[model samples]
Target: MSYKQILYNTPPTDAINPSLTTTDGTFRLSTIPKPSNVPADKLLVRVHYLSLDPAMRQWLTAKRSYIAPVELGAIMRGQSIAQIITVGSELSSKFKSGDWVVAYSGWTEYALLSAKEVEPFSVPAGGRPTDAMSVLGMTGLTAYFGMTEVGKTKVGDTVVVSGAAGATGSVAGQIARIQGAKRVIGLAGSKDKCEFLVKELGFDAAVNYKDADWKKQLKEATPEYIDVFFDNTGGEILDACLARANRDARFVICGAISQYNTSKPKGPASFMTVISQRVTMKGFIVFDYAKQYASAVQELGSWLAQGKLKRKEHIVPGGIEGAPQALVDLYKGVNTGKMMVEVAPVSEALPSKSKL
Candidate 1:
């Protein structure tokens, strides 16, 4: 039997903007032999869904970052949901062949993963197992920590979220509302996305950053100015949020996707406002709060069950063959919410084991 995998064949041209490109040889897909013998304390997993995130592009860069970059000719790094096909005798007491887990399994159809390297997860109420990759997953955890720990959102504070239609930003805005923000405004890229943010996601208002009058709309949406800014799209939107920041505002720098694709990286030009407004600006990674993930997931899960939180996802199908296109589409902002690719379909019709 053969299993497919995607490899890192070409590093990006620049370090800062390591966006995925279709230029020949950027990524290569190949078939490899299936594992014939699984080792003890290890499980053979069939990959199901592979998360497509903006940060995946950044991981290609060899720059000094929170984490190391993927090496040349190595498997592309990604978080995925996989089903156990077979488990080692040492691990059989704790796990079964049908059990599901989320792991940093990279871009492969089947992998031999140790139990310690993956986490067993169950679907939260109002969330699917796939949510372990999206709203109820690391993205949700990022929003939770970015809002409560870093952004310090408070009741009646006016909040603003950039890239609000994306996975992290969308949940960040709603969590702001759940935190009792008086007004929650979002910055999205399209009119439909703005509408989705305001109508479906329950944001107080949403501004289309692509609109010519975006600044005006942002101003109109937050008349009292922003007390907390959860910034994802950094360049221009970061500057705009700074200009509208109220006194004693907090800026949680979760990501800077806007500048990711550019040749020259840019910073917010409105630093002066940070001084004038007595702002508290900081950047944080969710890994820093790893210890509290379980508790945070509990609270986020409750909100999701109570309808205080919402998420959207764009999943590209076609098995491993669709992985490259999914990354390309994600960078183009072609996905409205959490973007991912289906490596193998989750099947429920199997006799005892399903969800490959």
Candidate 2:
């Protein structure tokens, strides 16, 4: 049978305009043959949702990094929620057909993935398996590890989160509160996001960075020094947080979305603060804590079950064809929470119910 796929045919040059430039090319829908001979360790899956992450922009570059860049003519890489439709004979009993799973399925309707490359997940009561792609998935794990390990968040400490309304930042700020933070401050782009952070997500205070007096607001919100700063958008916000950091404060740099698209990256102007306060700023990749992912998932899942932690997803409807635009929207900060693309209707494999 034939299926639709989005191949990364274009590369971003000056700025990513998927419609006009190949620097980040537009989605190309194509028909491809199904795998006839299934390998013993491989499985066939039908993708339901595709994660739209800021990291995808970096993946398009040919520069050397921790992970290999996505090559031209290849499927755009993304984590997806899928269902195992066919399993190899050797793995039939281990993983049967119709099993929900999470995998690096890329931008396609159907995927032939290695069993080892995918992880099986159970749908929680009153929740769908798509939660595995959001709060209880890589995004959650990134927050859990970054806050606990790198940030070293402690009780009674004042915590601050940049990109506070976004996926990982929202979770990080909430987790800090649960861990006994004295105050949790969130910095977001718009008034609505700031309101969501303070009113809906239970943040102590929020600052709208787009406002002219945002710096004054940040100082007022964080009267005392910030103990932990979970930075997702590293730019002036990072510098501001650094200036107000307490002695030996911890800075967990998970992402620098503000600088991802820029040609000449700018460092924080308050570089002196790093030495003056003797702060501990560290950058991390989620894969570093892979061994303890299960423990973190169990804890985060429990929070979701008890309604202690909340999650929101900004789902863009359209299959592989919409993948390109969804990515652009993510960079533009149009998505409120976790940005995702609906590759197919989840109603077929699993219904979208109360999500994590």
Candidate 3:
């Protein structure tokens, strides 16, 4: 069978942001033979949805990162949902044909994935199959671990989050509230997003960084002093948060979206505050906590199932053709929640046989 795949070629140039362009180049639809090594226990998935995250930009660049860079002329890496069209020889124990599974299948329409490479999720959860990739997947896990572990937030403590309206930040703020935080403050670039953070997401306060008096407003909004700061956009915002941190506060550096595109990365200017406040700022890669992923996923799933948590996802439709642009949109702040692309429809087939 023939399938479409998106491949990246050369790296970006000085004029172009590789994240936005299919630098290298994009292979629209390419035909390739099906893998002959399919185990009976492995299922073939026709990818339906793919996630576009800011991390993808880092992956596109040939730089050291938590994950390896996408090889030249290979399919652009991404997380996707696919339906089982064929079963592998080893599949009889856990999964069967026609099951829907999430995998790191990249921007391809079809993928030959083993059961170990994918996880089964019910389609249309909260009315979309992509939610699994958003709130129920890595995004959710990031928020959960960043808040519970890195931030170590406690009741009656003030928490500030940069990139407040974005996927992980939005979820982190809400999780802070659920965990008994006294105040949850969000900072974003636009007025609309600030309003949404305060009105819809239940943030105690939302500040628009675009305002001329943003620094003053942040100080006023967080008068009690921030006990924990979850920084997603590391730049001036990070510096500002450091200045306002209370003694012994924790700063979780989840990402530096602001610095990703810059030619020369800048460091926080207010290092002196760390000495005065005795702050603890630590950077974490989510995979470092992989040993606890199952427990985190289970607890997060339970919260979603019981309506204790809400998820937001910005889904771009089309197939692998849409993957490149979706990744570019992430840096431009075009996505409000977890950014993802819907490659195709999810599978609705039921398993005909079960293995013990």
Candidate 4:
């Protein structure tokens, strides 16, 4: 049995520029032997979509972080929506073949997943199963928990979100409004994204950081103090928000994409604002609230069903080969919404497990 896979060759010192490592290669797309056997507690799955995330960049670096770096020659680590092709004998009663599941299936076309590692999910009515990988999946869940639990946003409070056009930020800004924020403002890199955030996603206001007068525009948009700041791009934007933070503000640091690739990371220059404003700032990882995933999913799904929540996906077509460029594009801010790689289409008929 053989399947295609993208292997992480080594850590990227700067960024994922394929040309810089073409000789030795930072990531290699190759076809290799598939799993011949699955343990009784494992299921064989065919990956249909691979999630493209900023965190993938950090995972490629050989640094100490919440998770281990991808090992050389190992399949690139990625969250994926897959279908169970062959159910292990012991797991037949729980999950049968053709059941859709989500897992950290990496960049392989097929995978052997531990029963504990995969969760069976039903595709939403009139929605693609890939939706479960984006807005209805971890991205949405991250926004839910980060905004509500971490930010502790209150009614009549002004909320500001960075990376407003992205998967988590777009949902975070909307959730804040749903949670009773008086005003919701977003900061994006481009004018089109700013328009999408305000017009399409229902953000009260959006600021394009690319403009020379963006700081002035942000200050004008947020006339009242910022009660909750959803910090996604933490370098300059976080500092700017801190300067305008209201007394006793809440700052939820979901990600720091601006500093992810920096060789020399530095803290915000306006650090004293936290003390002066008595702001509560906390950083969190989505996995911390794994037990509450169901509740988050239910709310997000309901929002999606009622059209209260809108989602967009920039899907790059190609199987495993497209993953590398897709990852680089994510960091370059080429995607307007949730970015993903379409590995294959969802269908009932798929290859069965191959026995050794």
Candidate 5:
């Protein structure tokens, strides 16, 4: 059976600040041709969901980053949930037909990948793999490693997370709390978001950066000073956190969503604070800790299974057609949690023995 897929066009001139028109884009949903002969080592998956991340915005731009920019006319790069439709070898016995899996399938309905390219999920019988893509996947791993490893959070430490209501930030704050933080302070863009951080997500304190007295509020909220700063939105908020850091504080710079669209990236103007406070600021890419991913996933999965952690995802359904705008929404802070677009229904067919 054939499937529909959306293909991206030429890259935008102003990829940093992409608009629908300037991006020179098109949404081509056409039938994907089947391979003449399926490779003996490849697996075919029917994608069910596409994750929309802030990082995607940065990837669209031809900038120097840990990862290379998405080439023009290529499928937009993304992480997604898929079901194994066909397997190519017995060596791929780790998965089977009807098995739900997660893969870097991009924004397409049907994805052809190598067995090494996909991670099989042992969903609870009838559960979906989207759960694997969200709570048990990259977003979870990002929060786990970025918080526990990079931040080096300790019990009784005052942890502050910028963009605290976002996908990574929200999970990071919870992880800090689970690590026995004295106080978990969340900084979000709006009052409602702050409310969600405090009430729904169990953050000890929530401050809205939009407040006129945001600096004062941040200061008041963390009277003991921030010991571990998990920064998702850089710019003024980062500066504020820097100004309020305790001695030898750990600042985990995960992403700078605030600067992604700006022609010029803005950071803390003062290094004197870093010197005076003796702050140890470091940036990390999630892929850097790939070796520890299985351990992290296991721990996070246990937490999730035991109800010690909660996962949130703002799901937009419409397959590949919804991916681009969902990315735009991610930058706009319109999504409340882990942002993802459901592309298609999970496949029910099992892989053939020869294919496997």
Candidate 6:
């Protein structure tokens, strides 16, 4: 059996699918027909790679969020790299078949989107289109603004990043170092991931959050206490960082993957530490920095050239068929870096596997 697309379904709590891919209770492959023709205002492209981010989990909920939730039976929403297969007559002058671009292509083998919905992407010097999905893409931009604009990392600041081995958190930690933070420590799930952070990624040290002595490990890692906390996991880690926060430290809340699956998400028990420590805690969405993206990209691209920034992408198998389980595996910490699915051939070179 084959499918032209995949559809979003009721989540685990409200629904479930027995298929192994949909075991997490979200999506299922569908046999929808491909569009016979492209509209004059839109273009059709075959998806090459689709980014699998933790944020996609939040998009499944019915609750009010930064963006509207996906409606059941609709295409699952996502971003992807694609080669234009056809362009509308109106856009033919500017875009053509075979032109590679990025767009909100959803979880399908092909996407037909408006000219405004798809944009061209030029691989920067020493960078590949795959980087667009990892470092040079949303993951990188999220880290850029979260560190510079929100965290305001300084030369003397001792920075701590939870979920430090994941895409956004990994890049966020490096960006903190690039911005001159005195010490950069990471919080990861396992000893191997912790070693990856400290040895491969240049983190000053790392704490395995799953370890029995992790809290003591955290204290030992940040003796001067944390001046900036870049959080991707928000439960106990957030509470721990709150208690260890230096006065007026900045906490950049990029995500809360730890709480995404829980019915009653735990609020920080160290809530009073925010008051006592006079900490500045803020949650941010990447789109909030749209106006400043160009500058961020320029600087990030330069770092790519200078070797100051590196990236890790975990490309799962089975093409588009692999996406649902790949997403499910994200919360399982199966991927040590950015997670993606290659539905078709990508135009850029990617490392055989993530170094971290």
lDDT of each: 0.85, 0.86, 0.79, 0.86, 0.80, 0.84
Q: Estimate each model's TM-score.
A: 0.94, 0.95, 0.90, 0.94, 0.90, 0.93
The CA lDDT at 155 in model 3 is 94
Q: C-alpha displacement of 113 in model 2, angstroms?
A: 1.0
Candidate 3 on 1-356: residue-level lDDT in tens? 57778776666532123342433443333558767567655677778778776676667667767888888778878888666777776776666666667787887887877677788776444435566677777888898899999999999999999998898988899889989999999999888889888888889899988899999999998989999999999999999999899999999999988887656778899989999999999999888889998898778877777777777778787656677666667777877778777776443334423110
Off by over 4 Å in 1: 14-24, 348-356
Report residue 253 deviation for candidate 1 (angstroms). 0.2
Tens-place lDDT digits, model 1, residues 91-144:
999888777788888999889999886888866445676888888789999999
Question: Candidate 4 clashing pairs?
Answer: none
Q: Output the TM-score of candidate 5.
A: 0.90
**Local error of candidate 2 at residue 137 (angstroms):** 0.5
Alpha carbon deviation, residue 167, candidate 3 (Å) = 1.4
Off by over 4 Å in 6: 1-3, 14-24, 347-356
Model 4 TM-score (2 dp) = 0.94
Least lDDT summed over 10 consecutive residues: which range in candidate 3? Answer: 347-356
Count of steric clashes across candidates, in order: 0, 4, 13, 0, 5, 0
lDDT of 1 at 265: 86
Clashing pairs in 6: none
Model 1, residue 75: C-alpha shift (Å): 0.3
lDDT of 5 by residue, 253-328 (tens): 9988888766677769756789998999999988889999889988887777776777777888766666767776
Model 1 worst lDDT run, 10 consecutive residues: 347-356
